[model samples]
Target chain A: MDDPEYRAGIIDLLGALAVGELTAFQRLAADAELAPTRADQAALAGMAVAEFHHFEQIRDRLTELGVALDDAMTPFHEPYVAFHANTAPSNWLEGLVKAYVGDQIATDFYREIAATVDDDTRALVNDVLAEAGHADFVVDRVRAAIDEDPSVAGRLALWGRRLVGEALAQAQRVAADRDALTAIIVGAPGRPGMDLAELGQVLSRLTENHAQRMAKLGLSS
Target chain B: MDDPEYRAGIIDLLGALAVGELTAFQRLAADAELAPTRADQAALAGMAVAEFHHFEQIRDRLTELGVALDDAMTPFHEPYVAFHANTAPSNWLEGLVKAYVGDQIATDFYREIAATVDDDTRALVNDVLAEAGHADFVVDRVRAAIDEDPSVAGRLALWGRRLVGEALAQAQRVAADRDALTAIIVGAPGRPGMDLAELGQVLSRLTENHAQRMAKLGLSS
Candidate 1:
């Protein structure tokens, strides 16, 4: 905890999470426009607002740590931008699946990393990552859409797979680019971090959770 | 307050306000994309979320009154849609001006109507219409832009006028289309409503407030 390297790593991790939540807020709000009904739109907007609240929490934490927000958030912007561009949803159902599937995978990855950090940071991560009750809304919408036309399931299943692939690709990009952040997970000098085997297990856990989420949405991962 | 006509009018007004705040959230979120910096984007997103909270309050009030959310919201959707379409901001500065100017005007109108409603409804309206502290951000940004390039002030000023015009136009459409809502403002049987002279005074006050907000943003109304 006294290591400057560890402190920097924690800051890097928090910055990434903060920016990720902000982008999620933006994406969800934009997707709300595709909703078929006002109710659906408001529901998506509610989820977007929830994401913004999470972003605010992380942002305040970063500020409390005396990190200039733009300086911290700037590094991860390109990766997130690329991720969203690659997996832009074509319709409302796709948007719902992306929000649920993509968000769950990211949450799982963060939670895994969070466990390696200090108690306060871990709690902050858990707080932001706590499900905001949007999963049921997304699941209900996606399942109903699939039920309406079984043929749509095949397309959405593929969409879910693409979301996961794009998310993982961008996650890898961030890891390779932000050494401090990767150090938070992979180990820094005088700091305990995930061994290779543990990292493999974390990946598997993320994968399994994503699969379960897709299944909950009646989609094959 | 016991009059069914008055009750229906209150419901109608709440419905219009709920949908208005909901759309305001959507529009602000969409406009956030035009922001030049991440901080600017987050600021707009924050304002959008504030609007969503306002929407939730009004929606809850309508629900408490046993009004269906969609039914209450449905009537004013077209008006709001037209208002946004007619005043779509073309650039970042335009978006800021529209957000600040349009929202302030809407808030003023609602505050006036809230004055005429029951205490509970008036309190709800006041709560939602309270400024969420984004005005300073908008004013700072717009004023800085105008200082940097005086030419923008002309364009944004015109943009501000267009926003007010479109807002008033749609508002008129709503008032004409929804007799119950208008009855709340104009008068119902055995209900004290605004006399024609008072209605004229309300319009003047709204216009005066708009001019002040425009001037605050370094724009002419």
Candidate 2:
């Protein structure tokens, strides 16, 4: 709160998270509609509900920090919404893969960014980012689908790549649009933060985790 | 579980509630998408998540009763699904009104039927039927909309009526099809239950509550 740029960066980070969680809730619920069974629908819908709770937590934190939740969330809304629009899944399997892949990237990004924030904010971010066991459900369903029809593996793999591409593109768009936030991630003048090479390593880790997730789902990264 | 009719009726009741909650979660989440703002979307999505919890509780209870969840839920699935399909709202306001009115009527019917069940099941039904502050949110939003455009009041009032009509028609369809469930409601031979006259009174009470809800929403019932 003392340094204006640092404060703005934190706000920007949380604001983006708030908007991201809100949109994730919407997308997950919509994707759940594509579920083939009531049980599966309930499973995906539960994940959406969990995302809503995360949205609330971040939104409440914004209010607690004396920021108007809507105004704080406004900056990153367009990019996040556009990411979802651009990568809208073509089918149920695609939706599941998107949910899994998209969420993993978001969680990883938040975890990495968590290190640069204050202790309280770091804990909040980490706590909210926990996947709530949705990963196993997604992995089981995706693997079963691939086992049933080996041909789907190629399409789903391609879909996973597209999700990651759209996610990264939107993230870059956000970073470009929010300079303070970008500075925060790459470190301000005297702050401890990621240098360019370290930033490259962060990206590498994100994609590496993405590959592991795809492999777990029986799809190529 | 000793009496076949009683057992079947319990299964039918739980099944219907499970299906109702599942559809409500989907419909509420979809409706949340139409919200004019992210705040409103989160508000409605919170309600949808509450519905999902109720769905899970009922599904779990079915499992505890040694009933196969899907088979237990199957009997009421078509009626609930058809009701949603036929009465799908065309816009945000209609969706809000339908959620409030539809959920209220369902809760009322369940409360009445709860009287015919064992204490444990009755308690479970009542617990799940409690709205998680969703009614106030819907009422506030719907009332504000009418305040913004008085003309929408007439259209919304008509929409409310259609919702109730479709709901009652579907309720009747479920009752006619599920004999054990109907018999439980109307009273098995000597079981303490709603007599025909008592059932008529229940219908009047449901409509009366619906009218009060509409009035509260600043719409004509």
Candidate 3:
């Protein structure tokens, strides 16, 4: 937070997160409509509402920093928007899997990146990530769904892999596009950045966690 | 609150409100996508999130009453779904107009209905309806849009009318189908309900308020 580059990187990260949450709120609300039952709809809507609150917190932080929210968020909007557009769920199960897997990946990325930021920002990020109750709800729904129809697991697992691929591709694009933001993560002067080896470890951990999540949902990732 | 008839009516009212908020949450999120700018999108999403919270509160209240939420909300779902389907906005301005006009009518209806229920239920319904800041945001957007193109106001005014028409029709259908709920508003044992003259007065008040809202938007109702 001291260095200008570090600050810009932090803003970029938060902006991306805010926009991601905003869109997630929209997509999840839309997805809730696809649920066959009112209970399922309410569960997904609850998750979407949680995401909306997170977005508000991050956006308020940006405003407190005297940044124009749109300007701060503009650079990162396209990539996240494209990610959602490219991975629009085809059915209710796909929507649930997307919500579950997509949120975990984002939370994992946030946690990894939080380590390089200042204490305050790290705390904020951690608070957002710690709201994990919704994940279990999604997991239970997905597991129950798969239990009812085992054949669908294969398609959903494929959907899960596609989500990961699209997410990583978008992440790379954002990193390449925003040098300052990338510097915050990969290393810049006066900023604690991840080294090549550490980066590899992070990726391995993310992939392993994703695999475990898919397996937990009775899917073969 | 103690009478079974009163309790059943309260449950039905809360159930309808819950489903209304759920569908409103969905529709507003979809409407947010039509926003021309990030700020507008965020504003609408904020509105959607508020609706989600209200849904949760009403759902919880129903659960407290030993009513299964899905069963309570299911009957009201179809009418709301049909209403939204019939009045889906064609653009950003129309969306804004819809949000503004639709919310006011719903709030007005809630206030009228709140008068008949017990104090506790009245307070809960009033709390849900009292969230008013989003209206100002929406009003500003609608007025600004009208300023940009006067002709657009004509289109939006018509859109607003269609929304009210569709809303009233569906509400009538719901009232006809759910006699217990309707009885609470029209008349119930020991429940001070609206007489014919009072009902006419309520209708006039609703229409007058809607017209004033339209005029505030620089539109002829």
Candidate number achieving the greatest DockQ relative to the actual structure: 3
Over A1-221, each residue of candidate 1 has an lDDT whose tens digit, in order, gives 47888888888888899889999998999898888888888998898899999999998998898888888888988899899989888899888988888888889989999999999999999999998887998888888887889999999988888888888889888888888888888886767788989988998898888888888989888
Q: Residue by residue across A60-79, what tens digits does model 2's lDDT show?
A: 89989999877788888889
lDDT of 1 at A187: 85
Task: Give stretches of model 2 more than 4 Å off.
Answer: B190-192
What's the TM for model 3? 0.96
lDDT of each: 0.88, 0.88, 0.88
Roughly what TM-score does model 2 have, to 2 decimal places? Answer: 0.96
Q: What is the TM-score of chain B alone in each candidate?
A: 0.98, 0.97, 0.96
Which pairs clash inside model 1? none
- Residue B42, model 1: Cα distance from true site in angstroms: 1.6
TM-score of each: 0.96, 0.96, 0.96
